[model samples]
Each structure stands twice: as structure tokens, then as C-alpha cells.
Target: MAETALHNTTTSWSSDFKEITKMRLAISVVFSSVAGYFLGATVLDFVDVLLLAIGGYLMVGASNAYNQVIEKDLDALMDRTKNRPLPAKRMSVQMALFIATAFAISGVAVLYYINPKTAMFGALSILLYVLVYTPLKTKTPLAVFVGAFPGAIPFMLGWVAATNEFGIEPGTLFMIQFFWQFPHFWAIGWWLFDDYKKGGFAMLPTGKRDTKTAIQVILYTFWTVLISLVPAFGMTGRLYLTPIAAVIIGLLGVFMMYYAIMLYKKRTPKSAKQLMFASVSYITLLQIIYVLDKFIR
Candidate 1:
């Protein structure tokens, strides 16, 4: 009976760890960094790539854990986040903080082994997310703008890890992801407006779902589509996209924009959710297209 109880406890703790760290979200963030690494690497080193993935995941996990710690009360108020480890009372704040601190230290150390710049950016991402963006979430709608800086870092962080330098290529990569977030997050904000209101989060640009917010989404989607095509014009140095790939990417952007337009026309939570999904698909496919075009073309 004691052995069985021990096994159950172990399983529960494992599940709590996954929830606290937001494992799937951390993995997706790691994917962006790895894709950037592949794009920047002239010759691939699997070891470095592995380290990048591990370090990147650890850093993102740490950021998420810290975020939950800070927002424990607010998280408990939201339907979407109420069941998270801290908010659900499955884990104590001290335990979460310990895990976050360990992950942050280990993540930075691993990244430093790659290069100082990569480590610097990783540390900066955590600071910006926790110190700046997290606090601003309830204060102003511009929090999304602030959050974009950290959110966009992973893609360019991968490039920096590979090249150990900052240049137009990584800058272009950063810009693409930076602009992409406005639309992506706004869709989520729109869809979950009520849930966010419960937590007093100023997520939507206008702080409510309306014409102005929809217009901003359309405008940002347009800019994201335009910026994504910039590399195809041979302006971003090593990050140039081919003509065919540009066409495909352009089409994908248009596909996402179509959903954005639908959200504007329909102005419903259902449409907002569709736009959110489209944005995710767009970004993932865009990364795959960029990586494939580099290798194949």
C-alpha cells in the first residue's frame, strides 16, 4: 500500500510540474528557436541545437512558472487559468519559485556555454517577461506591445546562438515574429475577453471587442504579411527567400488575413477563435517554409 501511494504521489507531482511549467507551450517556443538556429546555421551541429532546445525550453518554462507565481490570485479568478498548479493549490508558491529559479539559472548557464550573447538575450527575455510585461498586464493595453519584445526573442535567440552575432538577418527574424504577435494575441484576447475581464487583464488593444480592435488586428495582419515578404526582396542578407517560397508565404499570410477579415465582419467569439487558430497555423507554417526554402533552395 505504501509503494502504491508513493507511485500515485509521483504521478501527481509529475503532472503538477508539467502544468506549472506549461510544457507544451514551452516546447512550441523551443521549436521557434530551433527553427531560427537551422536558418542561421550554415553547417548544422546537432549538439549545439540540442543545447539550444533544452536551454530555450528551460528559460521559457521558468518564465511561465514565475508568471504563475506572480499571478496566482489573478489566475485563480480566470476560468482558463484557475486550474494551474499554483492557483489550484496543487503546488506552493515557494516550490514554484524554487523550480523557476533553478530553471532560470540552469537555462542561462547552458545558453552561456553556447555564447554570452545568447545567454544575455535569454536572461533578458525572462526579465522583460516577468518584470515588465507581467506587471503591465493589468495596467495598460500596451502590455502586449511590451510582451512582444520577450515573445519575439526566441526566434532571434536561436539565430544568435548559431551565429554568435546580431545583424540584419536576426533583426529581420525578430521583426517578423514581433509584428506577428499583435494579431495572434489580439485574436486570443478577443475570444477570451470575458475571461480576461474576470482577471482584470487589459489584453485587448481597446480593452474591449469592438471595431477599433478589429481594425487594429487587420492593420497588424497586413503589416505582418508585408514584413514577412521583405526577405524575399533580397534585403535581409543571409535570410533571403526565393521567389517561389515568397509566393507560398504570401498565400499563407493571405489565408491568415482572410480569417482576420472574417473576425472583423462577424465580430463574434467564434470568429475570434478562428483567427487565433489561423494565426498559429500561419506562424508555424511560415517557420517551416522559411527553413525548407533555405535548405532546399
Candidate 2:
């Protein structure tokens, strides 16, 4: 009976750790990093892929842990985040802080061993996300813009890790992901606007889920589509996106834009939720298209 009880407690503890890490979101971020590495690397060996996964996870996990620590009280006030490890007391603040610091140090150290530029980029991402973006959210809506700066780094981090240098390809990778964040977060803000309000977070540009916010989503959506096609124009060097791939990726962007328009026109929570999900699908599919296009062409 004691062993059984211990097993249950251990499972619960593991679950809380996963929750603190925001595993799903971190995995996607890491995936984009791996994709970027695959694109920029001449070989894309197993070791590079393993390192990207480890480094990306620790970096993002550390950010999530620190974010939860900083927002513990605010998180308790929100329906979506109230049961989080920090807020619910599943993990003490000291424990979370220790874990966050350890993860961050390990993440940066690993990347430094891989390459200095990649390590510096990882350090920058953690500092920006935890130090800048976390505190800035409640202070100003402009935080989203600043937050995107670090949020957009992972996709390019992979490339720099492989090449050990910065180049136009990584820059282009960064640009596509950078522009994609506005509409993505705006849709999330629309759906969770009330929850954000409860926490005093001005996540939306207008601080309201109305026409103005929807228009901003559409504008960003347009930019995302346009910039995604730029690689097809022969400007991306050996990274040509090809005519068919560009057309298909362009159509996918159109689908995302259509949902944005629907949200703007309808101006309802349901429409916003739909757009939010669509944006996830759009970016994930867009990334897949990009990776596949490399093989196809």
C-alpha cells in the first residue's frame, strides 16, 4: 500500500513538472528550431538534432518556469492558469526558481558547447522572455511587439547553431516567424481577453476585442503571407521556395487570412477561437511546407 501510494504521488509530481514546463508549447518551439537547423545545415546530423531538442527544451522550459514564478498571484486569479503548479502550490516558489535557473544555465551551457552564437541567442531569448516580456505584459500592450523579438528567435537559432554564423537565410526564417506572432497572439487575446483583463494584462493592441483589434490581425496576416513568398523570388539564395510551393503556401496563408476576416466581421469569441486555432494550423502547416519544399525542389 505504501508503494502504491508513492507511485501515485510520483506520477502527480511528474505531471506538475510537465505543466510547469508548458511542454506542448515548448515542443512546438523546439520543433521550429529543429526545422531551422535542418534548413540551414549541410548535413543535419543526428547529434545536431538532439542538441537542438535539448537546448530548446531547457531554454523554453526555463522561461515558462520563471514566467509562472513571476505571475503566481496573477495566475491564481485567472481561470485558465489558476491550477498551475506555482499558483496551486504544487511547486514552491523556491523550487521553481532553482529549477528555472538550473535549466537556463544548462541550456545556455549546452548551446555554448555547440556554438557561441547559438548559446548567446538562447541566453538572449530567456532574458527577453522572462525579464522583459513577462513584466511588460501587464504594463503595456506594446509588450507583444517586444516579446515577439525573443519569441521569433528560436526558428533562426537552429540555423545559427548549425552554421555557427548569421546569414540571410536565418534572417528570413526569423522574419516569417516574427510576423506570424501578432495575429496569433491577437487571436488568443480575443479569446482570453476577459481572463487577461482579470490579470490586468493589456494583450491586445486596442485593449478591446473589437473592429480595431481585428483589423490589426488582418494587417499582420497580410504581411505574413507576403514575406513567406519572398523566398520564392530568388532572394533566399540556395533556399528557393519554388513556384508551386510558394503558391500552395500562399493559399494556406489565404486560408488563415480568411479566418482573420471572419473574426473581424463576426467579432465574436467563437470567431476569435476559430481564428486562433487556424493560426496554429497555419503556422505549423507553413513550416511543414517550407521543410518539404526544400526536399521537393
Candidate 3:
């Protein structure tokens, strides 16, 4: 009986750990970092790649765990987050803090083995996400804008990890993801406006989903598409996309824009949901295309 109880306890703890860290979200962010790694790596050190993945996941997980700890009370007020580890009382606050601290320190130390710049950015990502973005969520709509900086770091972080350099190449990657986030997050905010309001979190540009907000989404989506094609024009040194890849990226942008326009026309939650999915698909497909193009050409 004691053995069975131990097994159950272990299983529960594992599940709670995954929940607190947001494993899927952490992995998706790690994927973006790996994509950047593939682009900037000249020699393809498999060991470094492995380290990058581990460090990326740890840092992202730490940030998420910290967010949960800070937002436990607020999270309980929203349906989507009410059942998370902290809000659901699956884990104690002290335990969550321990996990977050362990992950953050380990992640930064591992990244430092890769390079100082990589580790610096990793630390910065945690600090900004937890200290800046989490607190600002209830204060102003500008939270999303402030959040975009740390959110955009993974793309360039992989490049820095692989190259130990920061320049136009990584800058281009940063810009592309930075602009992409506005449309993506705004769509989510549009659909979940009511849920977010329950927590007093103002995530939308206008604090309400209206024509004005939709118009802003459209503008940012357009800019995201435009910046994505800049490498094809030789504007970004050391990061040249073939004209064919450029055309492909342009088409993807157009698809994202179409949904944004649809949201603007309808101004409904359903349309916002569609735009949100499209924005996700757009970024995933864009990263695949960029990485594949780098290898194929």
C-alpha cells in the first residue's frame, strides 16, 4: 500500500511540474531558438545544439513558473488559468519558487557555457517576463508592447549562441518576430477580452475590441509581412533570402493579412480566433521556410 501511494504521489508531482512549467509552450519557444541556431551555426556542433535546447526550455519554464507564482490569485479569476498548478493549489508557493529558481540558475549557467551573450539574454528574458510583463498586465495595454521585447529574444538568442555575435543577421530575426507578436497577441486578446477582464488584465491595444483595435492589428500584420521580405532585398547583411523564398514568405504574409482583414471586417470573437490561428500558422510556417531555405540554397 505504501509503494502504491508513493507511485501515485510521484505521478502527481510530475504532472504538476509539467503544468507549472507549461511544457508545450516552453517547447514551442525552444523550437524558435533552435531554428535560429540552425541558421547561424556554421559548423553545426550537435553538443551546443543540445545545450541550447535544454537552456532555452529551462529559461522559458522558469519564466512561466514565476508568472504562475505571481499571478496565482489573478489566474483564479479567469477560466483559462484557474486550474493551473498555482491557482489550483497543486503546489505550494515555496515549491514553485524553488523550481523557478533552480531552472533559472541552471539555465543561465548552461547558456553561459555556450557564451556570455547567450546567457545574458537568457537572464534578461526571465527578468523581463517575470518582473516587467507579469506586473504590467493589469496596469496598461502597453504591457503587450513591453512584453514583446523579451518575447522576441529567443529568435536572436539562438543566433547569438551559435555565432557569439550580434548584428544585422540576428537583428533581422528579432524584427520579424517582434512585429509578428502584435497581431498574434492582439487576436488572442480580442477573443479572450472578457476572460482577461475578469482578471483585470488589459491586453488589447484599445482595451476593447473595436474597429480601432482591428485597424491596429491590420497595420501590424502588414508590417510583419513587409519586414519578413526585407532580407530578399539585401537590406539585412549576411542574411540573404532567395527571391523564391521571398515570394513564399510574401504569400504567407498575405494569408495572415487576409485573416487580419477578415477580423477587421467582422469584428467578432470568431473572426479574432481565426486570425489568432492564422498568426500562429504564419510564424510556424515562416520559421520552417526560412530554415529549409537556408539549407536548400
Go through the candidates in order and give each one's C-alpha lDDT.
0.96, 0.91, 0.94
In model 2, where is the ten-residue run with the lowest total lDDT? 234-243
Ranked by lDDT, the better of candidates 2 and 3 is: 3
Query: Candidates ranked by TM-score, best first?
Result: 1, 2, 3
What lDDT tens digits, residue by residue, belong to model 1 across residues 104-137?
Answer: 9999999999999999999999999999999999
Clashing pairs in 1: none
lDDT of 2 by residue, 54-116 (tens): 999999999999999999999999999999998899899999999899999999988888899
Model 1 worst lDDT window (10 residues): 81-90
Model 3 TM: 0.97
* Ranking of candidates on lDDT, top first: 1, 3, 2
* Tens-digit lDDT track of model 3 for 141-206: 999999999999998899999999999999999999999999999999999999999999999999
Best by lDDT: 1
Model 2: colliding residue pairs: none
